[model samples]
Target: MATEKWVFMVTAQTPTNIAVIKYWGKRDEVRILPVNDSISVTLDPDHLCTVTTVAVSPAFDRDRMWLNGKEISLSGSRYQNCLREIRGRAGDVEDMEKGIKIRKKDWEKLNLHIASHNNFPTAAGLASSAAGFACLVFSLAKLMNVDEDPSHLSAIARQGSGSACRSLFGGFVKWTMGSKEDGSDSVAVQLADEKHWDDLVIIIAVVSSRQKETSSTSGMRESVETSLLLQHRAKEVVPKRILQMEEAIKNRDFASFTQLTCTDSNQFHAVCLDTSPPIFYMNDTSHRIISLVEKWNRSEGTPQVKF
Candidate 1:
């Protein structure tokens, strides 16, 4: 394997997801197990997604990655965890044309060169990490000939970013907060395929392109430490909301869908405000947009938008 000059590569693209029933807190930080069940809608991959190419070569000295054409560190525990997990599941590979044969055990010794690019702006309050991690895991899994399903691969992606698990599936997906301590059962399941709700239209308005002052990881950590509303939301409010949202999705009840979506988003913001020092994710412009949408809904006698 060391003498081979050929590089085995695979490229994959994954879409980002918007959580309708948000996952804000974690029960296990290291494993990235969320405190409550959350549901998300996977966006169109053609519109917002990450394209990652993973190449494994015997000549490469160490694992490396480039994000958006800039070299980035792979020393982070998240990246290392995903890499290790995927490597552990790798299967034997043979490329007859390239005259390359890689045994399952050989994956551990081989180094990887990964290059990822996002079509959308990263760190601008969008779910870029979700798409990025999902793309990384998906591409490496393909390159290594991992036999695991998307659900199994999603568990690895979850360690990178909790919301990343939901990005592995299309359409309406749910991440069930599994009760297992090992977090093996915590995986994303598809409720419906992308074509199920073709009538639905989603519009995203970006208010700012700057990186957030408080990342979701740090913000959620603060909420877990300080916000009582976060605790209650996880324990009491989200449970009922999850069931209702699931039902609304199953039945395609647009009215109930709009109601639940708006309420859950408001509650998420409320929890943020309830945090110590009150993390502000939405600015004045965001507030104005919400107000305008609410007024429009009132005038129309039905909900028009879910912000």
Candidate 2:
């Protein structure tokens, strides 16, 4: 063991993702294999993201973490999964200036101190978990010298949060629901880089709600348990939509893109309604917003009109 006590760290930023084609249910919870393909837009990292700094030092006694300057538990399975995966792939590190050196074997015994900060408010209900977990995996990979590409690391991030896999790449992303039982192909891929469709302006309405009566996770599970429509959707509907959405993104077809996005979102919520105790994610306010958009579109008499 080299007698270097100096600390080494890596900082990285990862953006949140919003699924245009949504990831609703999982086939394998532990492996996080999706039942259907999902497409998402990697939001601007500057707007909503997590910035994480991961440091490894022999001085540390155990793995510790802090989020938004507040010390938090690292006992969560998500965090542990990411930490364990990255540590297993850790490589030797040498810093001539700081006179610090870390061997591949040393990483197994060393504890890491991780600190993360999110740009947006956690209360916003925007997928902060996606950004947080992506940032964690990304920063640790940098520190560990992981050789896998972003898509490979994305498979690891998927275990943290279903949506997080999309954030491993920039611009539009797609999480392919592969057929393999081992989930080797269940990874995110870039649909198009950010520059491909710069004209796209996404607006997020911070709707007021007194906590969703049914969370998307539980609601989807209920749908899978009871709804025949959901089964049909996973088996029949999504595969075609995934192909169309890919084409829309590739050709910058806003008309096809908007239609598919709106329809898919509605179908997902509709599946919730098919459950025994229906989930009402969209309130009167949500309905009113939809009506407003509908009326405006009808007045325009063109499907391709933009907001």
Candidate 3:
């Protein structure tokens, strides 16, 4: 009897997320754990998402991947970690008609071919990593029949990027900085769905998103090493701000939301200045945009910038 070659694949889409309460640092670098809790709004999946198709075939010899239709090296630690974790949880798969039988043990030996695409501009300041990892996990979960819920799967995505955990859900999400040393509890939870506050309109204007000279990772690391304000902001300010932000979200108070978001952004910038070399995430153009908004608000005599 002659055996036939088999190809089985699964595809999934996931949205990118923007943090209102930004994730500035990490307590556990290897686990991609954060120092302080962060909250984000999951953008519309239709507007921005990564579509990943994961396939396993008898003809494949080793694991291979493509990003945005171009072959990208999976040699990075992030890719390797995600692949290893997902593969460990692989379950049984079968196709009765094709007589294709993939036992639980076969997953270890069978190599994978993955192709991913992003709808939005990757070079833009948007959070591509968040969507990319979420899709990677989502697609793999379906392919392997992993029984874990979105929150459990978020923990897996977190290993790929610190901000990615929040993209597992829609609407407002909070990435709780779990206390466990093993980072088992560090996962995202939904605070409010998109329809919870229908009247609010959110606008994001990118003044000039030229690739930041210092990556957020290196910039935060420098801040942690030198900035005196960093200690107080993390230890004192963020704890109170988080509670207030939660209350604002719960009550749908746009006034409170505006104030807290603006203040926290300024405070973060101040901490950047307090760094020895001074890392500036926001440029002069950012200030100009803020000034224009402030002038417009004054002219209207009321907060017209709703959303």
TM-scores of the candidates are: 0.98, 0.93, 0.92
Candidate 1 residues lying further than 4 Å off, grouped into runs, are none
Error of 3 at 61 (Å): 1.7
Model 2 / residue 301 / CA error / Å? 2.3
Model 3 C-alpha lDDT per residue in residues 1-307, reported as the tens digit of each score: 1146878898888989877777787777789888889888788777778888999887888889998888988888998888888888878887777677787777788888999998866745678888999899888888887888889889999999888889999889999989999888999989999888777766666666566677766777887788878878888888888999999999988778877877887887898889889877776777888888788888988766622
Show where candidate 3 strays beyond 4 Å: 1-3, 96-99
Q: Which is better, 2 or 3, measured by TM-score?
A: 2
Scored by CA lDDT, what does every candidate get? 0.92, 0.85, 0.83
- After the best TM-score superposition of candidate 2, give how far the Cα of residue 304 lies from its true spot, in angstroms: 6.4
Candidates 2 and 3 compared: the better one by lDDT is 2
Ranking of all candidate structures by their TM-score, best first: 1, 2, 3
lDDT per residue for candidate 2 within 137-229, as digits (tens), equals 999999988889999999889888878889999899999988899888999999799999998888777676255566656776787788888
How high a TM-score does candidate 2 get?
A: 0.93
Candidate numbers, best lDDT first, in rank order: 1, 2, 3
Residue-level lDDT of model 1, residues 1-307, one tens digit each, is 5375879899999999999999999988899999899999999999999999999898899999999999999999999999999999999999888889999999989999999999988988789999999999999899989998888988999999999999999999999999999999999999998998878888888899888888999999999999999998999899999999999999999989888988999999999999997889898899999999989988998777768
Best by TM-score: 1
Error of 3 at 170 (Å): 0.4
